[model samples]
Target: MEPTVASRPDPTGLNRRALLQGGIFAGLGALVATAPFFADSPAAAAAAPGGPEPSAARLKLTKFKDPLRIPPVLRPRGQGGHDELTVRLRTADVTLHSELPPVTMWTYEGVYPGPTIETVSGRPLRVAWENHLTGNIPVTAVDFSLATGPSPDPLSNYPGTDGCQEVPGVAGLPPWAAVHLHGMLTGGGNDGWMENLIGPGDVQLSAYPNKQAATTLWYHDHTHHVSRYSVYAGLAGLFISRNAEERALNLPKGEHEVPLILSDRNFGLDASGALTGRSVHKVEMVGAQRLMRPHHGPYTLVNGVVWPYLEVEPRWYRFRIANTANSRIYRLMLLADGRPVPGAFQVIGSDQGLIDKPVAVDGALNLSPGERAEVLVNFGAFRGQALKLVNTFQGVTPGASNQRNDLAEPDVMQFRVADRKPVTRFALPPVISPTFKRVTPEDLPHDHPHRWVVLVGPGSANLPELWEMEEIDPAGITFPSAGIVQVQDAQGAVKTLRRTAMSYDEGRAFTAAHDGVETWKYLNLAAAPHPMHIHLAHFQVLSRENYDVTGFDRVTRGSARPIAFKAASVLEAHELGEKDVIRVGTAGQIVPGPNGTPGELVTVAVRFPVVGRGVHHCHMLEHEQHMMRPLVVSPAAHLHRGGAGGHH
Candidate 1:
């Protein structure tokens, strides 16, 4: 029998108590452990008609199963931004080494590493994200709240939680996550707010208004605590937003335009394709073998093929590249004439969207997970020549809080130039689209009404007498969910984070629309630099505020503190108009906070979708679901459509 979406936990088998301790731990532990393995792992190796190695067996990894075989481009689903775009997620089993049994996976239409979503920028789009699972986050009934007391996390449990979370549609899995357009102006309320999770039988609304930045934006699971697990467990993919204006640039269109989704994964050759991981500190890993994909792996897959190959025409091609790997960073380089293709890709856009001008790279291109780039490559110059796409992110030395860049040898795929058929276009446009303006600190437009929100991390709670715990909880979980983490290298500076089930900020809900204009600040107390993001809307970097004040006193003495902005280097960051994601720098370069982390970042104005609903959370899916999800949107025409909880 197939696994039902929402089956009651073996009611006849066991009552409540036992399910809580065993099922919850087993389910969460499995989710957390299996995540990193699927980053770029592909489904079973189909025959490579025109490809590289038979399989990337050298690198055994996990990856999202490709979504149902849907065409890349699709029509808008909702009248406004909440339309439904159909995406089918399924799973299959794969054979492997040893006498291990086959591992089962919840796949995308039966294939790993789901499909790419191609659409236009500025135009509203909806995605009907469907979850068809053989198994899921166990459906056991378990309470996920912090044992007690108010969570000091930046996020508030009740704020963004509309009402949707009550129903558990999928198996007992934590509400994994929904789609969040990485770098585009989208709606706030339905922006994949972490709390608005969906299940097998249930559905959640992901609505957003497009600011028309006309750039490359992507979609991935943004669950707070489970982000590292979900994305790693094969729940990530691509999104392309285009605009009429961008079309006029004479860039590659239709077939010539390609979206190269990059990712990695590690899977056990046995057990129906279930993943296995050895965390740095999971109490279980002390004896188990849950390794990070980077630390291991011999082969690489491009578009779901180990050392895969592709056929390209000798003409100017627009490649929308997305690095969907959970932990690996890929420094992409085209190997032309044996050696690396020197300065091949001229990057035109990044995570948020288009860069003001195109920037060319020599030898290699570095891409971190969740990062994307749009480039123009003239295949005409290298027609008939075989190009090997190589991974170069694995250069960093192992051991540390930082992720791995050791994907260099993880050669993704190959591109062969068939004889160039005569075509009108010979070269790519020197420039893609007209430049977008950047909002500066001085004289910015005001949003409808603004409330100061602080991006706080659970600090002080993690502080201990020894100054540094040789072994600390990774995120404060037990057993398979190792909670021990390495402390930041601040030396003797006291650092403490409240004991948390998850490491992300607690979400706080906010309702009220900023009629198309408003400035907001994102203050961060977490030690790490989080790539902060919001759906349905693009925001400007108004200024960065760093205050040395702490506690209630900081807000009280706020008038004395000032905010400032630095010249952003990331070309795409200068959005003359609105955008999706913004890099909120840490405290001090622009401002300081007495809490030792970033205090606040003044943001540019934004416009909610016509219906007004979207999500605002950390771009890092792992952090968002755990505790970083929030619901902030404009006044809605169909407010009651979603309810106090949410659409799901």
Candidate 2:
């Protein structure tokens, strides 16, 4: 059978009495002892391959009872030429909701979602990220035994086999962290290398040149193996870069602007069946492999508050939204008086910066992990009426029935339009970014560099792997394994390719010439969708095409064949803007066969203006820790063969 996407528990189907009788919610120890019971249950059998889905009983929490929190903007101590500040990663007890007790979390600057740091374009900023966290991870569900080990049977209760050992410097050591500024262009040394970890009392100083355009960026923990846990524990913050051009547009400013940092989380239950308030990291078995699925919780946090409500004046407001979830993809839509409100907001910017013109959001706006969007919403017409920000995303579990789970919480937040007069009246300009230019294939130099990166999966332990591919002549090539694929180019010419580096430590597989543009084609051959993120540069999505995957046999042969390319019109209008992350692979589709499934090919055009080493991988924190690769950028004259391009 083929590997399936991880399935979430049906919140309504959870038997509270049965769980109590089985000692599942008795305590953390009892929960572990009762793992086999759930593994054999129908719920476990239906489990898929994404992230962990805990019981609704454990994730119980009230929604929309508390006011939303707008993180305070950090004030730089220095000004003019360069700005500097200090951010500390420490543990604190935070009140996530009004009814629930304070939850202990590892935070940046002692708060969840941290404090927002603002900067100016062309200016420079420096930060000292201090690691003040001490003790084991805050999440109760962290299983270090599964960190580095062979696959374990779902029916067994043993933590692992005799060969199962913990990852050194992570399992038993004090908490460590490495911070990465997502969507920021900087050198690798300052880009937060995964393995360059810092322990308690240690600080990792980073400098940002701020040469790029004003955009929405965020910083989070990037430690090699523990990033998933650290980020879930709340070590994340917003970094906004501003420019004169954006200011001249007269967009909403000061009190009219808000930052919406979205995240989802599940709370644990204690022996008394009371909410523990601490976050939980649950794992499950998929086939013969023990997998740590991406976490999706019952509670939706907007700016660190669960299902919060934000009061909006009767005026146009700018909302900078960032999806900081560990895995969940939010399909957001605004509703007034319980009816869909189309064209209620206009998207002005994407991951990198403002697009050429504002794209009116006709319906729902899809935001995957690590992606950001800036929009302008006018609440003038809805004065005295309440609006709801809801998620219409129904997750997909390949090879399973496609149905919306009623128990899934769709309500994200409530927007209460106060019956107040507008502070000022202003109209949106026709063009928000006059300097913005669209990038096209024709603009590239002749014979521009190109690289094929494929997302492969279910390799050893049912986990996905990223492959840096190189094409070879098909004259004498024979199908040997599943990693090999045959792709048809634009002219209908077929080419054979195979996987190169499969892990982060394998070696650097991609190299780009400084000041030159390269087209990177990402082919996803996995059952789940991957939001691929590239560091040190922003890229434009050229196109997305669907390919046939029914021929590829994972057990016996490699038989992937590219079908006639079809444009994916589902790409949103705002997506045309430059981005640092792009979603690829099978999105929301049930697997048609047991051995193979359809795939998606996403092509992007990236220009390497900064020369240094950097990494790229799925923004899904779990996938990134396991399936990431490194790349280097240097001058064209110094580029040599036998690296990423040598295979051809």
Candidate 3:
């Protein structure tokens, strides 16, 4: 819900009133068109009066259109900019009800777990996104009622391709969104061009700065307009950035180091367990509700499975954990092997990648949306006990009773350590490290070749200005303005237009891929603290801004997301390390790389690479697809790069 609103309608006068009618009440002709603002939650409850019998999770077909597929992209890994990615947007049928969603989703590449992306820092990537839509663009309420009733599970893929240049599991959709690789240090050139979210027949290209501490990251739509709903309907995948520098660490490899991308979803199906289309020819109301676990699902999933199990041997293991939930935090812990056996958690990396020193924690690790953390668990002592990785984050959520009551339910998995251990043993070292590779000020010819971008959100006060500027596009009203902005009250038949910046101050206009170091801050002014994760480079939280109490003595308040964080990575350290995304805490103050030291503020010490560029932006899928800006990273040395799109 980035601040993106129009005072009036686009050249196509589809004002808030029209937008609401289409999204909530379909086929209402004129009566439903009378009111502009959408029906609030109470209204949704009122619309349904008394919901159907409170049943356990069931499968349904929220959308059974087609698949959103894309081409497999392979770019030569390096410390430069963007690699190449070919993304296709199509539609498909999906059956997911059981505590997932009642709404349809238009994903990048079809399937629950979309396609995979791999690149190196500095190697910019070019993704050609082609969108194809069938039903209404934003998927109005009318488009969903097509389902007669609910049915069985195991949803199926769409029918024949119509020769739709198919790409395995991915297809396309109506509403379009550009890809944003959250956390990459690339420039605007490779950044996910969120402003370019198109409809059928539209295409776009973007890049990134793949330079950073080598690690695993992710990519998703940054279209803040439909952020929540879009991602809830499935539109997220992983970004793998490898660096040759850290290979000597001798960390877990092969099956030892595992990447787990976790998400929660519910589907919609018909009474006969069929792929029910969008709203029936006519619709009533369309919106979000808490059917399963209230605001978030009580059931936890590791790599899309409920209480999935994993077998672990008596050795060191690298676990990459990502919290992809729309709004759920996991306080994770490993039920260490019995006291007889030696057991402890070693911290190798964080949201971005491996940390310089591996810290030790007794138990309980936390993970938030769009955040990634890498750690090692030693099972030498409990070579015989049955251990489990669990989430003790009970009260953290509102309605977690369902998952809390079932210990095995909340239990992520189990580990059966091998009876004997010998080869390749690992332990928490006082300081784990990486090969630093940051560029010096001298390396960057221009004294001020750096770029300064901010994450901005236009408040309710800026709707008029936004409309006046005509930045509003043709797509119907997307945001709650259903975003992180002040929810405006609709008076009478007129609706207020207040735009919010999904990821505030996205200075795409200013971050056109640079040739060296870069620094930017995600300044959020909304009430809700968002998890700001970047791709490509692993940046440390340099400093936090202290806020004074407001109202009392004209004061403000201080805030911090993932509040546990102390200091962030340094300039030289992050430059040479391998990291994709960094968790920009809610403090609203983000400092890239190590500390800025004296006389410096909001500066990220980024090093220029010798190859292509990569992308850097928010990982929150929905936030990215809408209006999040793009960034590009270039090299210091003079050179010409062939503007080759991801063609083949």
Candidate 4:
């Protein structure tokens, strides 16, 4: 049966017109004052826990019935020192699965997952991102008022009409777009600032220097407040940077190399309980508050195909895997005949570039949202066998009672190895990148800057907050002081800190001197894990420690001194590589100190080579729209004659 839109009553007692008119959750201030943290709101009382379930039409769809789609490579107009290209953002009707009908989506160049743009390192590539979108945005179930009430930041005002004046005639507002090249080292003007939005008929020209090492980077919509909706409507693509250093390795090329872009979506149902063929933004009730949580559906998409399968030759292949999901964290593993494949994944690189050496991963590889991994898999051993790539990570909605596994997909995709003889065997290199060097504290200058960052949540209406921390003297600190937290320093001495900046508009609290190295400590105080991403810089994980989250008094905004300062195990081989995004405060078990705490404190070292203004925030698109802040890198001060100060 073909999926069609039904004229059924809205399940959450909120219709499309009402949602666009900003009727639902309009009285957010009143709801936050009277509602409990986990209680159901009147509007969503009839909704099931963990939001709505997939419709009957969607549930009947089979898994791995369709072939995987490889996004076409985008051709550049010119070559040599510089290249120019134009990418159009427009609406298209795409058939996501064979079982479902064609759904209208806002895509880049009229294709889902867009097209892959490959470039040579050190070359300058200029792209004109043109917006040609028409009509209302494809996503309808979004909560535009979630971050509305009583926020000083202008970005917090969702569906704000001020920014929509350019594009008229659409319900609520026309689609706005700001293309961001994730993990690229570029100037602040071309970095896709969140508020640099362009409506229909507008164009945004960006130039990427591509001076960083060869690696995998992606481009996605980054409009403030509406990014989650735009990206979900299909506006993302991969940009690969290659150089002679990486090509000399001869790892995998041509048909042997593949790009796997992973994403998830949930379809809306009509009045007849049939699929509407439209992506739905899920909403959950947490005690008198209707909160629109991150969308996680039963359908899993790989390169725009739902539960797709790939036919691989009986040889070694390179896979560049990227998790583009808004909020899902995939613990990916390879299995054959329902059993684990030992050393299936030989990871060679991370987000930024190649690691020092390839690490064989016999277990699962944890990939958080916005994270990417370059893995090499050998299919020669399993020539006639079919392998399955699965996600073992079970996701849980924050504050939702329904811990239903059905809502989260376990099966990602399938790999059917062809039954054929090997053409030519390639030996795996021990040292993938001979030039790669690990960053250590000894290499940094003495008195390098150290910054503190904290992730806290449920501040107002269950919203998550990212805070810039300032250290204070513990001499006269009182216990249970409001907005103050006590933690153990690296020397096992007690240190008091206070939250400084919580909003995006807050003046830049983090500053670094050009060519200077800095260390940052991220403390996760919230229940859920946050993939903290720093812009325009690649960092190395210095250390990780466990903390006592239960000791944090949310009411008093204070925390106990005992953060259980103990050294964690050595960093994972894949983690040794440079990364732009780091998962903080995961639920995984770590080495605990005297007190078996449940929080995480991660420390990382970064060297700022680019002088510009950029923003850092959680990679989860929903959280990023609300929890983001600015960072600035300034020119180093001139040294005096015979002065002790010098560039690191």
Q: Pick the candidate with the highest TM-score.
A: 2
lDDT of 3 by residue, 1-648 (tens): 111233422211123454343331121111111111111245433332112222233322121111111112223323233344455554543322222322344544433344445555445556666665345333321112113331121111111112122222122234666666666655444555445576678776654545555776776665545555455545666666666655667778766766566664332235655534331111111123211111233334454333333445667777777777765555566655322122356666665666777666543455657777777766555554456555554333321223222221344444555556534556456656544333334544465443333333223322101110112242465332332121111221212222322233532222223334554443333222334444334443443342211111101111111112223333322222344433333321222222311111223444434233333444443333332333333443232344432112
**Over the full model, what C-alpha lDDT does candidate 4 score relative to the true structure?**
0.71
What TM-scores do the predictions have? 0.58, 0.82, 0.53, 0.82
Q: Cα lDDT of model 1 overall?
A: 0.44
By TM-score, is 3 or 4 better? 4
When sorted by lDDT, best at the front, the candidate numbers are: 4, 2, 1, 3
Clashes of each: 140, 11, 147, 6
- Put down candidate 2 lDDT per residue, 200-295, tens digits, no spaces: 999999998888898999999988877877888888989899999999988998768888899987666566767667775543333335655455
Task: Between candidates 1 and 4, name the one with more favorable lDDT.
Answer: 4
Better of 2 and 4 by TM-score: 2
Supply the TM-score for candidate 2: 0.82
In candidate 3, which residue ranges exceed 4 Å CA deviation? Answer: 1-110, 119-173, 198-213, 267-295, 336-344, 384-386, 392-431, 437-528, 533-538, 544-648
- Pick the winner on lDDT between candidates 1 and 2: 2
Compose the digit string of candidate 1's lDDT tens values, residues 1-648. Answer: 111112322211112354234332221011111111212223322321133333322333322122101112323433544444556554444222112233344444333444455565655555566655546642111112233432232111111121123323333454345555565454445556555666666655555555556766666666545555566555655566667767667677766776677655443222433333211100000112221111123334454443444556677778877766544445566767556665578777665666666667754565545556777777676765667666543232211111122222445666767665645544545655567555564545442445333443332332101100122323543322222221122132322222222223333354545444555544443333445555555565555444332332222211122222223323222223244555444411222244444333434555454334454555443344433433456454433456752444
Name the lDDT value of residue 409 in candidate 2.
Answer: 60
lDDT of 2 at 543: 82
